[model samples]
Target: MLKRRPLAVLLGLALLSGCATLGEGGASRLDLIRQRRSLRCGVSGKIPGFSYLQTDGSYSGLDVDLCKAFAAAFVPETGAVDYRPLTAPERFTALRTGEIDLLSRNTTMNLSRDAAGGNGLSFAPVVFHDGQGLMVTTDSGINRLEDLQGQSICVGSGTTTEQNLNDAFEARGIAYTPIKYQDLNQVVAGYLQGRCQAMTSDRSQLAAARSGFADPRRHRILEEVLSKEPLAPASVGGDQRLADAMRWVVYALITAEELGITQATVQRRYNEAKRRPELTRLRRFFGIDAGLGEKLGLNDDFVVKVIRATGHYGEIYNRNLGPQSQVPIPRGLNRLGRDGGVMVAPPFQ
Candidate 1:
């Protein structure tokens, strides 16, 4: 027999355990944003046209813009963005360890990432729809996917590209080996060094990589797309409320663009936004009463601020990768609702 501990001691121990769980578990993405007055986003350190550090300590690219938009939506001040660069292997770990509140590094949304036993990361919404493809030296005469048979393909390790390539080749009974590298630079270096027959990744990444080569015309991207990659922002766990806020923030941008509301117009139409019923509903979503921000531990105007700061989804894309930009990624499947693509936003009502 053993003597029982004091009731007060047992109660105190229980409280401490509960507090421990609350400290980490209770901390939501919005909570972190409010406390730190910024949004901590995880991104790749050197992925050009996606997420890259600029000369002035600022992040620039499509992914970086999205993170900035998120921060603006969660907080009015556009400066409330703390960009944390991460690697392919470190992205999910950083989220799970609470080092970053969100992942916006052109990460593809897939089952393994959201699975409980896997990366345990949940997606927000599909921002960009891309596909895997191959890029080879134009002089090499590799023009089609079938040409990759028996060829060594350069690919990044721990990415969906590996499985996508395998699946495509397996279906056609073609045998090929993949030379996986830890970074895109290494993959490009190997391809340049004559170690790889071809390189494969999302077409956008392939394009970005191609632009960085010594001779852009030396390589040409294959026309065949292997898989549907719905690249999206991600967070750890299935926190529905937090995820919903972020998801709709993306939706709001799409909707705003569809409605032709530009960032420059947000101020002039400020009262118009207040008067419009649909806009009013959006305001509440961003926390104009209903204690929504308090519920998420964020400021009331978080979403509003994001919109005001970033314009909308269309603006973000066009600014970073549209026909006007150097990358010029064609908007294939990212068109708005009723525009032949599937970028429909649910009504805030």
Candidate 2:
């Protein structure tokens, strides 16, 4: 007493179900980027060495270079990036709402952000290893964290820096007053006006702020690091393909440095690799026959474009935050792992 449907109807129903699944899955962000022919990257343009808006109305800095590298990899034209400058409080929301395709600001990765604060976002590999620190006029004679026991500190509101400052001070049982401001500019103004005895933020940011002071020599960033800050780019979660592509783009930069590849040598080496069968790994990396880039839904020569645009990791750092730049923070923990730092790229193969 059972009835069977026609084969045609059954096939049609199965096809409809498959179509629903495909629609629910949606197009990956990568596909969207290719279709749109551009990548929207979020950045905090206030910081000098990380992401700064120049007087010429152009953006430059470490984070900016990363975004450019990403754009070169994702877009048809090399270095085609739409940079959206966001504040500390606005960065995450902008990313979650798809106002920006990627966030390449100096954002720290932590448990709360990776889980709760991100609202279903995932961070890429760590690009910069930083720590919270304080800065004060040398005249203040605040050589260490304890010296600011009773002093008021100028901090930016709605940032991890403010929270870390409080936690560090409380942990040492040191009493201090916090003068919170709405933005980095306000915090800097408060410190300059002597409303607070010291300014606190990530060490790199402190150095950048000090460099802009009328008399940069007057201030000094203390050596005391309050908390670990692993700065990285971020993207919306739930798309493993997009996440892997973003992560590998960062990894390619680091790997290029490890492999003794630089922008200056990239072209020469690429040409040389073709003649040498011994350069199989290099050939594979350049997509001679290996389909690594295709597997990731990208062109095989994506890494070449990335390097040509942004250079290697060390080169990017040198161009933005190294000794030649306005903020010359030493690459202590940011050096490659083989060189005694934590920056190790996974094997490309």
Best by lDDT: 2
Question: Which residue segments of model 2 deviate by more than 4 Å?
Answer: 1-25, 116-118, 136-199, 217-224
lDDT of 1 by residue, 236-332 (tens): 7767667877876787788777667688876555566566767665555545536565554446655566668777788888887776565656575
Q: Assess the local accuracy of residue 77 in candidate 1 as a C-alpha lDDT between 0 and 100.
A: 53
Q: Which tens-of-lDDT digit does each residue in 20-99 have in candidate 2?
A: 63344467888888888888999999888899999999999999999998888888464578889999889877876668
Give the Cα error of residue 46 in candidate 1, in Å: 0.9
Candidate 2 similarity to native, TM-score: 0.78
Q: Any runs in candidate 1 off by more than 4 Å, and if so which?
A: 1-27, 77-79, 134-200, 214-224, 275-303
TM-score per candidate: 0.72, 0.78
Which residue pairs overlap in candidate 1's backbone? Answer: 72-306, 73-302, 73-306
lDDT of each: 0.77, 0.85
